[model samples]
Target: AEEARQTTQFEPLPKSLFQPLPPFEDLPRPLSPSGASALIDEAKQAVIDTGSPVLDTEAEPGFAVMRGLALHKLLQMLPGIAEAERRDAAARYLKRAGAQWPETERDKALASVATILADSHFDQLFASNSRAEVAVMGRLEVKGKLRSISGKIDRLAVTSGKVSIVDYKTNRPAPATLADVPPAYVLQLALYRALLQPLYPEHEVSAALLFTEAPRLIELPPAVMDNALARLTGA
Candidate 1:
């Protein structure tokens, strides 16, 4: 419990892609009891059925969790990258990935997720005005009820005043440029953006895909955000 509390207090911060990014040295960790490092290591790296280590620097637990956070952030900011076209692209990429890059997919995903955790720009873009609140948010009306939106928005500042929806992507680059993005990711972000606009009612929204697998952050056009949100009106 103490460890968990410490984890909450020292939230993960992202590193910048430009220039030489700073290493995250300030994030705090609870110091374990004397001589407990061995036990902690055992707990962190327990083997799993999927043939993957639980907590690995090579495939760090922080990596996957950050990927999820990146997705949540993108959903709040730029979700267009994950809309129908992108989702379709993601699917096709995944298939091609399985055929041509199957052996490295897992490693690639780990790299993607890791970049998300260390994304300095990501942390800055999503940082809230309220210092007390680690989990910042906004809302939009979906149908009737006030819907909660804005979860870990990595590039909220980057929209340059456009409403952007974004999804976290772990897929690697492809010869087909669009296929580099995973489509289901876009769909997921689109739903979140559609939910937000009506609830917030003030902000002009847009969408994107923050590729954790690579350093690229891809934006989706406003038209895609509008069309996707329109489709959700009946639902």
Candidate 2:
């Protein structure tokens, strides 16, 4: 038995090692936002549900879809650009984004692009801060109910010692009024304020939601914001 065991151990391993490695090249790449959202019956269902305690990683993909659309619109509105040139630029961006989207979602994203451009409020704000210090992907960490909270600020603009935190929304038929805005969104901006206040002591920081679809800018009320901060910090 010892002699037999020694002979088996010395034998060359079988050619079928680990049942052959998977054909990695044949595997599909991770799905894009459009592709993933298409898998759901309703695109809205793809929106990250914030009810879970864990931070919403899935939110970025949908936000990316909206960001692409917002960029296209912002490009068209750049000052001093010829109307034809602006439209062409916006069209190119839309085409690139649409290529990866399902036909249904592509149509919706395209339609929403014009909505932002049509909003007087968005235009006024963008024009006013054309030279403001803009920060994208602003990151912050804060205490939360169950654990620490971390999030990315969509846009941060500081002008003349006044800091404005803007959160963009891509929801269809964006909230018509401040009251229509979601509590979660309001809480998010408040938390951003809490995190940024110490870093910019001299600047007066404020938070607002820029509903890209409705193109409305709704500032958070002082009372509501104070309450959110109190709850977040347990102060």
Q: By TM-score, who's the top model here?
A: 2
The residue-by-residue lDDT of candidate 2 on 1-235, one tens digit each, is 9999998889777889859687775533332211221222223443332431112234455545555454534533543355446555555665775565555554555555555544565554455454332433223222332323345555666678877777666555567888776665666677667667888899998888776544567899767877755544445
In order of appearance, the predictions have TM-scores of 0.36, 0.54
- Listed per model in order, the count of residue pairs whose N, CA or C atoms clash below 3 Å is 43, 0
Model 2 misplaced regions, further than 4 Å: 1-84, 100-120, 123-150
Rate residue 81 of model 2 by lDDT. 57
Per-residue accuracy of model 1 over 1-235 as CA lDDT, tens digit each = 9999999999676555455867976632321111111221223462122211112334456554453443343334332343335444444444443344344553454344345545676554344421211223445444454444444433444243445444444432321344444333444456556555664576776666665545566766556645444433324
lDDT of 1: 0.43
Candidates' lDDT values, in order? 0.43, 0.55
Worst 10 residues of 2 by lDDT: 31-40
